[model samples]
Target chain A: MNLLSIVLYPLISSLLIRMWGGKNPKLAGWLGCVSIVLSFVVTVKVGLHFFINSSLEPISHNLLTWAILPSHAILFSLKMDVLSFVMSLLITGVGLLIHIYSLGYMKKKEYGRYFSYLNLFIALMLLLVLSDQLLMMFIGWEGVGFCSFLLIGFHFESHKNMNAAKKAFVVNRIGDLGIFLAMMIILAVLVQEKQLWSLAFEDIRTHLDLFLTKSIFGMSLATVLCLLLFIGVCGKSAQLPLYIWLPDAMAGPTPVSALIHAASMVTAGIYLMCRLSFLFDVSHFASEVVMWVGIITALFGSTVAIFQRDIKKVLAFSTVSQLGYMTLACGVGAYAVAMFHVVVHGAFKALLFLCAGAVIKASQGNQDVYQMGGLYKDLPWTHAMFWVGALSLSGFFPFAGFFSKDLILSHVHEHHLFVFVLAMIGVLLTSFYIFRLLYLVFYSGKKRDLPGYITPWVMKAPMIVLAFLAIALGFLWTPSFLGSIDLFPQWMSSLYMIPFSTHSLWFEIGLSLLALLFSAVGLIAARKLFVHGPIADQWIKEKFPKLYQLLLHQYYIEEFYYKTFVHDGPPSNRKLSQDTAFTNSLFHFISVIKGMFDRYVIDGLVHWFAWIPQFLGSIYARIQDGQIQTYIRWITMASLIVLFYWFLWVSGMIA
Target chain B: MNQLFCLESYLVISSFLFVIGLIIVLTKNNAIQIIIGIELIFNAAALNFVAFSYFRPHVTEGMQLSGQIFAIFVIVIAAADACAALAIILSLFRVFKTTRIQNINRLRG
Candidate 1:
């Protein structure tokens, strides 16, 4: 199997399914699954090749030359190094499970188009991970973003879904601008200093020393580039300021929420950072910014997730918060740990989202945890899967999230104590909210009577597979204190030159125990408050009504953003209208002035420019009356004038 | 040459024909009358060419009959133009139930 086939298989199948699979939706879904399976098999073969050879050389193949320039050529190349291999393995594996789950979740009528989009997403995501060049990776980045938008707005019949998709897209573009600018600066600096214009990862690595010697705007060039690229990461990974879109992005189908938003596409940011860990390692200032933004986002996402009642919204925010953890790991110069979390997070989060999809399906599309209770009786398989996912996400011992989260916390502790404390609080919040969701959805209140709703085996199969992964995948990267094989970092050591962790075994064990304790506290608190019904929730709400409301409204950040950037006027203007009589009159006076300026200055200028064309057109309109006689009469008079001029010129009388 | 066939006489007669054709085209409402006026202008131009070629004083060898050949070509072209213009007028009449050019002003911008 060729390396190109890993990306090409899904792309070709997506087009084929879109064109010919319309008549038989089942066939379309099966075809999509088959293509992804083929791609996954090829990826495994590549992995096996690396294992057998034990060679540090990456498996790279140049598909085609995209462009030829004076200095260099841009090649559309695929490389399966340690980093790309791990990421693509996660993408295709999780992606395959999601595609299968979608067959059971999506409506029959939309199967062909839905699977086509899913397949396209897989193809683009694979491209994103496997590309050898930064330019090709950007193509995959934008392509996946496009696919995310398409899938997010799949239910285009609803205006809300469409709006959410647009929100996700526009926010992502803001981040994409950073990557674009970084690429430009890289090219420019390379051209100016070394007369080299290649954007391949290997080429950039070889020329890293050249960038350190250069400066941009009085700061190190590497720092600016890393920061700019982090902007893209923040957008893609849904970090603090740009995270509003991920929650809204749950407006898409549940399977899409599982695949694109939660599992694969959102992790592209972390993957890119890991891919360029060399540059990030050199820039301490950029790493500091990344670390701060990441920890703050972790806190912000988990805190807001606690008050969310929608099942998918909670998971969406959890995904955001978990993404923040991965970024945090990256920020603290733990690229392997970040990647390890990405892998383990991919397994558990995708499992949770798929379980959520099953629950939503069994409940006949109801997503509110407030309305759903005691679902463990009706959806036994989904309930079991959700337990696995929740435990893993909560960083319980023997679960996938425990190892990765512990590793990240240890890394943060080594860097800054303040951030470490905040990260621990984030960890507590993560466990609390996820268990809160689990308790509210499955254990609290009376058992829901879901008539004729059965969790299909097709869906159950993927969940079971993912549940096992969530339970066991953490073993890939056990800490040194555990005295186990740390295969993940060892596998990735070629890509990341930094040592995994240098702390003594006792310190590592202590931090792990501390992380485990925080998670336990969060679990006990959630069990006390939510597992027994609404009594404790009522007390909390009654006692701290303002704080409850604040959390429920997500700190009013979305509203503040809307008012400041999207609203037509200041939010204060609306408040002032209902104030005292003097303020009301003052508001009216201000409005009058504003109205006058708008009408006379802005509209008047537009109208004046518009009138110029209208005035000229009206004058010209009279000349084209379509009357042959009038046209001929004008022609005759013009010809007479021309004849007279010719006569004078011929006689030399006009000289 | 005879006085009736002289260049000056021919030029005067052609100018009169041109003026009459232009007036007919500018004033007439009937579409067929416009076609007839255009044919008259073509014939006036052809007549001027034949007259100038016949009355020239220093005609170059092998080019003496160039003006007469152009006159013949113009007459042939005028015949074809009359056919096409009449066909268009016929269709216009069928669509509007009238041959008046003013009523066929649908081409107005």
Candidate 2:
């Protein structure tokens, strides 16, 4: 609620761990759980105050000022608006659930260090969402990335986890580059007009005309900059081309996958998109590009999720696909819809991953679908919770996923019909993969025999809470938030988007019906093949070999990255030797070529003119008269003339 | 005293000393001499600053601010720099002694 909580959370969490200092890690886990719970409660109170009085009272706390130069002051502060309120609420609310879930999921393990990383993650996610300025947000951004790197390699004893952590960090750096570039562009625009950096949100937006309305290189610079930045979003949000890291991110603990991959870290890009919506307004063409890219990635991601063998990987790819939907929502001039999807998806998707964690831990880390069958018999709570999450994810009616996902498709339909069709295809893929995952793992006719490991009531509590939120939050949308506000129509007047009476009629009758049909078909099809059919897995792997292989292998994009950037790259010194003899060899080569051109072509003409004078100077230097004889002769002649002049009128002549 | 003051000679002597210092910094194998050469450059700059300060007193903080600041900064930088160089030299001495840059080749593979 106050500034102290923000700073106090990590401190107390650490101190609590130290107080419970032990090699045995249960105490540390409890300390982490208590700290996050306290932090979440404070954040919730703060969020409620801000949410209720959003327009008039902008909630902000100047936590501390870290530095102040002559020209600028770096104020580390928390600022909450409608956007931050939503993000902070979800982060704390859902983040607390994940932390609680971690207690049970990591019960037996040494999670002291792990909990510290997780606590730091919670703290950083709060900073990221609550901060008013870009730099502070980036610190959170980089902070979360660092924590993710730590958590993903939580099993640091394993080399695979370490490698995957490196991969995640490196891939995230690509997006971080975009963030850095966007900041640079903002700075450059400011520099042109003698404006200060003034990274405060409103200050930057007020100077929007200085950057966005300009043109460069035969195109609007703003559009170019926005498009460049979306590349960053693509990386962070696990969009195509840079999504390879996310699937591998499953190397961490299940709660890490749930927190970072499903809910928090992946949502960062969408959060950034919503924050910088002003830039998107100027970049019309960039928005269209974002729309198409989102559509394609959504479809591709769902397609890949269908073939994933590992349970967490399926959920990981599902997060990717679901994030694509949010990106698509943002792309098509629907901010509220995108935020809705982010909230809804964060709940259900995080639930799905955590439930998957329960199942995995119960199955003793057995993640393969073929290995895990009929879990429903032994693990009823986890099974039912998993189904609720799966159905919500599949856009079943009355689920939060249904309300949010429909808007994305609806906006795509209104604005870009082709993207709409692609999104529809994406929805079909989403249904297929989700139901398939559910059917093979849980609902298969054959029961998965497992040890009678009854999860404590604490484990089921978060699952039930998240499941309720996932389903019931759809009704919370409730047509009331849509009442006073108008959703501006695509390329049309706001009058077109005013809350008309038929809005609910269409959602209830048409959209809801389509959703029902999709769920029924997906459920029946998955059940028919996976539940009854004996050779379902084999049929998929053998019959659809090429597509299955491509999906399973993630389209060989990792190989493509290796061939392009890694193998032939300026080999990293960590991977190779750090040669002190060589540095920026490529730059040196370019400089040498530039030097040759400058000498022989550019300066050659100047030297051509200089050659004659240079030759003359060389000859004059050789003929220097060092002797005094010639000097003496010249002086005597001058003296004789002076003497003659002196005879006439020496003083007068001198004057 | 006025007749004896040859500004050109002082300028020439300073120029010669500055060039020798530059050569030492660029080409010397001994780290200590390089540090001394850097000190020479500092003195050259200080001499120029003091000369200008003496010639023009009423100028608005131009030579006053920058001259005094540079003089202080140069001394502080020299001290800090000597400590750093000494650390590097000590470390290098542990690896390869003789205080010569050329022999600091353990860094090479």
Candidate 3:
């Protein structure tokens, strides 16, 4: 099957599900599930074909031209390189699992709508990955955003869910503006200098030298465009300042959290950076900004996750933290490493979310970790799956996160030690929060004698598959000391090479050991804090009240935003009682001017403009008075006058 | 034919017919009288064409009967126009109960 068909298959299924899905939701869900699985099957074939034939350049199939311009045009095409193939596999493969899991998770709800949204998300994500041109990708980009909004607000009956959906969409829209500006700048620069106005990934790479040479405001055009694109990345991938929306996005269903937010959609920003790696490669300043923003976001999210008691919110923040690591990878010019982490993170994080969904289902919608206890005995399969996911997430040995994340750390360590130190701290917090969540939910306190809820095999099946992937996919790429086999990275190296740490093998091994040691410390810390009766928690609350409160309140970021955006004016809130009469009058004068302009200048122009035709039409209305004799008399008089003039002229008397 | 009537005489007859029709139509208020006036105008136009053709037999390159054909087409079109106009007048008169154009001014705008 063609690569385009893989995207179309799920879209066709989504439409079908919506049409015939009202009365029989079970069938609709299955239909949606089967379509994604079929796409995944085809993706597997395509991926294998690409990997087996190493000589093939990125195969592009131009479906049609999207727009024809005087200078250049963009094609509605699909490209299946190793990078896209990997992303496509992750999307469709993990998407299928999430679908099967949703069959159980959303069993009693509007299965038709849920499954249809899920199917559409997969289709759009595939479109995003497979698109050859950035313009074409934008369609899928906005499409996935819309689906994210729809799914986030799926339970629209509640005000909180609706608010969360709106926040996610509005924040993403702000980032989308940045993307649009970046695209315009790139196109404009290329057209001006190189006479090339194309949006294809290949074209951009080819003309990147020209783009780098062009200067805008004393900054390279490449730097400005890259920074603008990074803003879009911050929005989609949940980096600092724009990271607030992802936590609130936990209002969505768990499968949506797993598939769209965690596995695929959030990774779109990373994919974009990787696709435009050539641009970043030439812009050191922009890459530094990307690296710093990423590490800060990593620290920020993981810190907030430590205090979040809600299970999904913790996972949501952890997803943010992990995405920060990927962005950091991109920042360091480790494009292949970033993509490697994307694939590995897709597996385990999705696994973690699905397991959390099961736990939430078992707990009867109780999302707070403190509310539940001792589920390790009752739900063994879920506990086992959640353990695998947690281990992988914490970068434990032999799991997917370890290899990919260690790769990122080694690269960072080679470049900047301080940023590497910050990233290590982020890793420590990641493991601590993940383990804190694990121990608090599964191993702490006495077992509650609750009624047994049978989690259907459908949900368990996907978790089992994802757990296996979380454990095994790491072997695809490993460091030098562990019988180094760089399979995945080597396959994707044709797009952009991931700069391996030039440090010695022993140093690389030492870095891996440090990662392991930190994860171990985090695990032990979580154990001491959360395993027994809340002794450490109480001691911390009592001894360091302000710090505890600060962590608990998320450093009051939301309150700060609300105060600035919704409550008081910016200057007044910044300095209390700073609003003087002068400022007030200034504001008042502006408002008065605006009001006058709106009422008089704008409306008066419109009214007079309208009155012009009416005034002229009144004068012209006399000709058609519906009086036959009057019109005939006028015509006769005019004709007689004309004839009199003509006779005199012909007699040569008017000269 | 040229001995019996000259082009100038024919032009005077047609012009008189046209002026009389225009005067009668402008003065009258009845719908039937207006229709009679319009028929007179049509006949004046057709007579002008036939008279020109009769006086100047071969004015164009091998197109001797062009004016007569045009007059025939004018006559045919006038007959159709008269039938449709009379039918419309019948409907208007039934609705307003008047044959006078001034009273039957439903289509004023």
**Largest TM-score belongs to which candidate?**
1
Docking class of 1: medium
DockQ by candidate, in order:
0.60, 0.01, 0.43
Off by over 4 Å in 3: A533-539, A567-655, B1-109
Better of 2 and 3 by DockQ: 3
Model 2, position A478, has a per-residue lDDT of 41
Better of 1 and 2 by lDDT: 1
Give the number of colliding residue pairs in candidate 1.
Answer: 0
Cα TM-score of candidate 2: 0.71
Q: What's the lDDT for all of these models?
A: 0.88, 0.75, 0.87
Q: What is the lDDT of residue A625 in candidate 2?
A: 45
Displacement of the residue A173 alpha carbon in candidate 3, Å: 1.2
Worst 10 residues of 1 chain A by lDDT: A564-573
- Expressed as tens digits, the lDDT of each residue in A1-655 for candidate 2 is 4745854686568656645634758778777878777877776677566436633255788876765565655567788666776777787778788878877888555567777788788788878888888888888899999999988998899888898899999999998898788777776676567556556666667787776667777677778778777888988899887888999899999988988898878898888888877777667788887777787788878888877788888888888888888888878767667777888898999899888988898898888877777788788899899888988998887687877776676667778767777887778778888888887888676766687888777678889999999997766554333342322121112111222233444554565566567667877777778774235767877888887788877787765565444533332223332332233355456678999999999899899888989998887754434422233345656876887888758567554
Q: Over the stretch B1-109, how does candidate 2's per-residue lDDT look in tens digits?
A: 7744655555666677776776677667787887888778777766665555555548774445665676677678878988898888888777775788666545333
lDDT of 2 at A269: 89
